[model samples]
Target: MKPKYITLIIITFGLLLGISLLGKNQVSLQGNKELPPSQRKLWSDSSHRQIYPRTIQLIPQIQATKPWKIVFVSKDGLKGHQFHHPGNCRNSSWCSIWENAKQFGDSAGVKIELAYVHQNCAGIDECISTQVRLIDDLIAQDNIDGMIVGPRDSNLLVPVIEKAISNKIPVVIIDTPLNTTKTLTQVLVSDRKLGEEIGNWVVQQLKGEGKVLIINGPKNQYNASERKKGILSGLQTGNITILDIEETDWTKPEAKAIAKKWLKQFSDIDAIITVSGNLALGVLEEIKAQKREGILITSFDNYPEVKNAIVTGDISTTADSGLNSQGSLAVKVLVEYLENNQSFPSIVYAPKLELLTAEQLIQFHGSQKSKVKNQK
Candidate 1:
């Protein structure tokens, strides 16, 4: 063959080889030709099945638009009696979340709206139904640019969240985790870790041996269940005996009633662990009313009354899981993703758990006052 013709034939053969390899590498979604073992394995893997496409195609439009509306769906509404503190708006977690979300949204130049389940729900089932209805209404409105949800039940909220995603609305789960991975991001505290810390604190206070009681939140809630598990795991390492495990609606009256019964039944209860600050306050009030003594109390959350109890030496200690920041962070994350196409991890944990005691609370406030004085 001529030298030029020989070179041309070589190039044509190389192109054919490249095309053959490319065909083998591609995996077709619709066609059912037998794939190579490696490609077939990917389809059979469970982890691969969980992968979801990013359906939020409205980022560019949201970024180009001004004053996008974002809604925060809270688990419960603001109620003064719930907190038992003078300033309900300042102390309630629901209010804190709304205020922080609104502040952040305002700063980001987005409009923030808050919707919450009615507190008078007959039961957990009713409350969850209310939440589902609220989310569906928001999604159907078709005006919201983004959504941040503090889900009441992890599994029940999955369908609505997935629906929102399919509708091209980015959803960010806050406070409690959602069961589905279709969310844009999750900003929350590690409830299990916080519970473990509380357990550890109780063990240390009791010197590795004592009888304790647990006042837990609702059985079906994710945070409540995880925290209870963590508390149990932490207590297992020590010679601790759990006197009783009681579930509450995260309410003061129910917890107080439980505590009253326990105070009457058990005289040697060494410590009490509550899933929330409000519950702790309820237990504390009952203990005081009965003139009980020497019972150490530990709790979760950053309620104002919890802090006051720490300052007054009424309770042993409590964990601050950064409840104050979860809402703000969720709003911030969603807004950043909308405006800048920023990608974040599936779970964005708030600051680490801070165990608060009387001394620590006093010192923290003193330092704050000093900083203000210095600034002046």
Candidate 2:
């Protein structure tokens, strides 16, 4: 199989535009009646310079007075009990935000109540049917002032978000933010930068030549597209051949089915690159099963399975997006907005990711050595 080192390079600099896949075509806004055009990125000229939105205006801090009531809606579950977390949250860092928010609320004299959307972040249909019901209950019966939506849920819950905004309920989009217009402040990772990171990593790994396959995330998340741009842009300088790129809905089983199809179509493929943890897991299994050990497998997020795969030499590399940091930052911005009447940029790109090895994952999670190297 392709080594983890190669995967790391592709992710780190994959989206360095003008050099790889991203800059080949401009990512522009086209007027579509169904969807409104959101804020464009605020570009800055400097090496790794800060990229904040042009609309952001600095305002003075507000003294914490009344308790800030915050609600949490996550897609995760503990077994069939459901509605807890782990399933929908993928047991990702986003889940920890609940705890952090609770603690912060308590310390700052804020009241917080989290609404578990479901066992996992399944998509709009499931969220509307399940999580939306929970939100209605919270608004009608529960005692929270506002809500901190789980990442990627913003775009999925646009209509609902609009309703909340209309109700004067502050909604902050956590990780996987989409449709910043309806949100108070969208806080999450800089997918474009993450993509660039991947691109650079991939080029260095191939020494500039290979057939690479890019995997997209859930059917509608904005992060997936941006990450792709970064990956392609970063690969600009390298002689990388893209075999194909497909979306996997971020589901492992779905990814497996797609992998089987791809393996059959491109048996001689050189690498499989993805931005979803579950998708990467599925691809890794297919590669191992087919005995195509020469194929490189890489991806994003801090999912345990993906991290363990890297440790045991199954996955190439994955990055830590500080899942909890997503909620924390948005909370800071939202609290500031409510009190100071200051509005941050419509979109806020998160901090860069940290590279983690299998060993590091195990260490971070306090798992056993065997677990770190476990193979499915």
Candidate 3:
């Protein structure tokens, strides 16, 4: 064969072999005349089934985009993954925010890193120290450009949030306030309104005339104060007797102990209610122990025990801060800022609180009961 002709033949054979290997097509056995894929005894043993295409087809008019990285920091820990927290239920204030971020990230092909925050929420100096250290480290790392946070984190996370604001990392506060910080722009969910909701419910349930005990949060917390004010305002309507009120420090055991101690003193709390779950559980423990079945206990938060209590008639009511909505909103807000390159208010309140009762438990979404019922 002429050298040129030989070379052309070799090239043609190579190209045909390449095409066959790359495309999904049948190969025949020596004499059986059966399709290579169909005759295969096992899928794993087949070599002629198909091959990956080496060339990628690219559209000439489209441009590649960069992925946006969004970071969410909160003292409430990661939603749905925290050991004791109800992330799946969006129990954390930012659960909705994270959900929104996740969806938007997915849609825009962005990446998000949500940080489980730990800050001194007790208003204690030493605990605040550790929280400050961690938040400072994150800020100094300059790893993420944007942040969404709940400034009034337990104890005194507000101050730590100040450090974040100082670094000019745009942040949004939920369920708390940066009241003292001038750097904060906006806030979410008026805790005061939530308190008012509790009080209003109490007034209606008790005909605005029963004696009620108020369990509250730590002294300086903005949300705590607002909740107290709301409850007080709502209860001021008519013959509602102002019963003995105590501070639970928003701690479950503490609230329980306080309830026990106070119940002994008052002896006639027609209604025992708290704005925090910790306080609510405490009230439940005290009443159950003392065999006081007449006292109706109302509470807040999506704590499991709280939910169970409502389910079994152990407690009168429970409320959800619309976790999914809040989380989704936070993400929506953050994405807006990212896309617009504009400054946002320091706080973004998602005050959509749902009143939960035995009659309305399903409406408030007992996340578990609903799932079980759906499975059927």
Candidate 4:
């Protein structure tokens, strides 16, 4: 045979062999008849199945646009968040949030709107309804990018918050932590520590031996409950006996009624601790009415009344959880997340606790100028 002819025959045979091997490896109907039964069965098994390298598709990053619109939902009504503080608009927690959000938005070229639960919250039910409606409406809007909600009740706001999360909207909770991690973040003061601070202060004042009373806020509220827990934990160290504990809605009338009943019932309340200054004032009125003097009163939220009380020896000491600072930081966190793609902490605690008393009145007076400077 010629050399070229031999090479051609060899190449043809090699091609034919390769094709036959490929057919046996596959279970295609067209080639199955060429393979043995056992070979066909093995080819159909998953071990012989087709395979490819796994791949992940990366999403393109979006540049944050200017004027990112945001909505702030406050548990309290718009008017309620406005306080008649002595020097600054910083007195109202909700108002402070609104103000700080606006300032942050202006600086960051973001737009913010404040929404309240209800102007007239006849009851807790109405408050919840109004808040739900407001938030749902805001979420439905196409222009809004995110939400900052200060929930009135931790549990009541869970559903709406989940709805926001489902819609891919980021939520930052302030003041009170809702019982959900679905939120982007929470801005809070250490409620338990604040409570413990007050409790420990009371114990020290009474020299670790006295009958103390707790005028607590709403029993179901997480912040209020945490404060109560902290107080109990702090009081655990001393010989102080908790005479009685009452849950109020942080309302003046309800606190007064509870105080009246307590005064009539217990003759030995060495000190009274209230979760809010408003409640403390209510209790103070009843005490005055009963002519009960020299009873140490400690309260939370250094409101104007509480400040005056501290100065005049009416309220021994009060805790101010840096309301304005909490509000300012909440907005700042949301802005950083939206603009810079920065991840927010699961829970962002606000600045440290501040104890307000008559001695700090001079420093408090100086705060007004700085507060005004920052607002500008």
Candidate 5:
């Protein structure tokens, strides 16, 4: 017999064994009440492992016959590592996505290979070309079975992703979305909603009338565009005047430079809204260096340094985009499709964005410490 048939037989036997064990154990998988409505339908199979929902059932019974190779293409590789570390995954959407995807891949018997377009690319055009070339090469080589991509430019990646789909490889878009609808699923957070909430907070802080500066990510990114729209919508409810809107590469240095220039130009800026945690930190650094006060800084992504700044009252608030959930679910969705030919919703929104403040973090930490003391 052929290797493929033999592998199928092995997987079939494992499922049978899992079913038998289930009969004996009667294990039940409980749905997490905290999960968003879209992902609340959790289920378990014979092995009693909880799997993501929106499946036809008997999903856990399906086993991969071979180690499915999946490639995760991130827009930023090295620069992302500088902020998103394993130890501080909670503070980074990228790190959380990477770690959660790896963990899920291990459990589902899939091999996830990490790739990036920003590895050595000199500029935006080069990065786009590099990403296109990399995905084309992977498809041409016929090595990877699935792809999970956090695209830098939503439009630029559509054709390459379409080509991958035509070649029959499953693709999952995460973090940022692609413009096309050909991918298996896109796992993401509502960037607009997060921005709106932050904008509302700013309105409240400045009493519905103040000058605010918007520090946004690259205009090419879908998330950045959505966030700008949301922020504008939220700010419209108030008498807030947008002092200036600056675009950056979502890096600290660029944000810092912009903040420095803005501080000099606009002396009475009331609030500063940044699209990323690093940008917020950069703004905070510049504010402190200049001994500026009462700016009411807000940012997206709950980075550890940002959290610390919040505690110090240097930053007002930040939103958590549920990066870990997005990462894990992206892997789960892709693996399910690859293993059992399961169908999923075209877009799977991650758990809702969480707005974080210093007061909330302090209370949470106090509760956690109390729990530890009680346990001891």
Candidate 6:
């Protein structure tokens, strides 16, 4: 029921921390055993999994010797968009996508141009307008061969996407889901399935009978809606009663504020289900500040804050969408189509969801540290 604009101030100032949740404490690592060999192989800062899916047929050798020009449009500027840049000892899926795309593009002799929407530059509406204008300009150019974009708003960019398609350009959509299925390709995890996983985890933790609250993403966004639906479907088999659901802009303060109010008003809330770790961190802060205990929580995204929260017993569980694999694979698909005239499937699954608990977080961090030490 919270309006989107109410939290804009908090979100504009890097409050979301790149979809990262916050924790009050850090848990120490005590184990000497490195992450399992398989897990170590998959935990790269870029490309969570290096192995590509085996189903796609082999792409033909490149016929074009000239470098193809491709453009990538992201939701926000480089720093604000945490996906592409790896800082703070964390490598995000977006970073992996960009890194992989660049690496593959260089080997294939292609150029990848980055266009940041700068959504926060002026405001959401103005940022969108800028993106539209940029897309239009890019489309008008004669030599621009392809585009990869994730729109800020799902429906707002449909017309521009239509224009690109009409221009005979191949568009590979990544991250956010769009309404039209007409795009050349889409790269994202199954939102509904991820939501169901969270819901099922909650049901199991609570033993299927308790009042629950949900903190979801923006309204009507494909990913947000699908996750909401999945959570509801998963909870259907249980005796859980939904107390309320709030639509968030994926900011921490807004989520924390909402969670605080709900916690004060509803004493029977046994668990919290959030779509992103940003909201989960906010909610957890409220629970921690109030000294509330035994309320289970779950969310998506494996941001360090969320990982630490798991270790400190603030979050019950979380899921990772394998951003690294998704980014690299998307680029590979785009390059294959561009260079070899090979077409990719309409929908491709990057990798299965990697679910984690507190113990797993600790072990994962240990393995990362060990890997880093050996490299040094």
Off by over 4 Å in 6: 1-55, 58-66, 76-79, 82-109, 119-130, 141-143, 368-376
Query: How do the residues 1-376 of candidate 2 rate in per-residue lDDT, one tens digit apiece?
Result: 4789888777777656436544332222111111112443332211122333222322222345777677766544332124334334343434555655555556555566656644554654664466666666666654556677764354556766677777888877776665648677766677787778788777887888878888887555577778888888987868988888887666677778888889999867777888867778888877778777778777786644556678788887775555554554555566666666665556665444655556565564555445557943
lDDT of 5 by residue, 224-324 (tens): 88888889988988999998999987788888999999999988988999988888988998998999988888888765677788878889998777666
TM-score against native, each model: 0.79, 0.67, 0.68, 0.74, 0.80, 0.75
Scored by CA lDDT, what does every candidate get? 0.76, 0.63, 0.59, 0.72, 0.77, 0.71
lDDT of 6: 0.71
Q: What is the lDDT of candidate 3?
A: 0.59
Question: Tens-digit lDDT track for model 1 on 1-376?
Answer: 8999999999999999999877754423213343344333211101001111121111221232467788988877545325433235544656755666676677668888877764577667787888899899889899888999989888988999999999999999988888887898787777888888888888888889999999999987898999999899889868999999999888888889999999999989999899888789899999999999999988887666678888899988888777666676677678778777777667665444668888877887787789889999
Candidate 5 Cα outliers beyond 4 Å, as residue runs: 1-39, 42-66, 82-85, 88-92, 371-376
**What's the residue-level lDDT of 80 in candidate 5?**
67
Candidate 6 lDDT, 1-376, residue by residue in tens: 3667767866775766643433211111112223333333232334132433423433322324667788877654544454434354242334435555555567667787777654454445666678787788788886678888867777788899889989988888887776787787777778888888778877887888888999988777677788899899889878999999999776778899998999889988898889877788899999999999889888887756677788888898887766545655566677778766776556665556757898776776688789999999
The RMSD (Cα, Å) of candidate 2 is: 16.3
- Residue 361, model 1: Cα distance from true site in angstroms: 1.3
lDDT, model 5, position 87: 66
lDDT score at residue 353, model 6, on the 0-100 scale: 72
Lowest summed lDDT over 10 consecutive residues: which window, candidate 3? Answer: 44-53
Ranking the candidates on lDDT from highest down gives: 5, 1, 4, 6, 2, 3
Candidates arranged by TM-score, highest first:
5, 1, 6, 4, 3, 2
lDDT of 3 by residue, 1-376 (tens): 8999999999999999999876543222212133344333321101112221011111212211546566665545322235433235323324444554455556655576766544334433443455456677778877675665654344466565667767777665555555544432343565667777877788898875888888887676667778789889878765788767776456677888888787788866788878766578777887888887788888877545667788788889865654434444555455555665544433444333566777665544556567779999
Error of 4 at 342 (Å): 1.0
Which parts of model 2 have CA positions greater than 4 angstroms off?
Answer: 1-67, 75-93, 96-109, 119-137, 151-156, 178-182, 335-343, 354-376
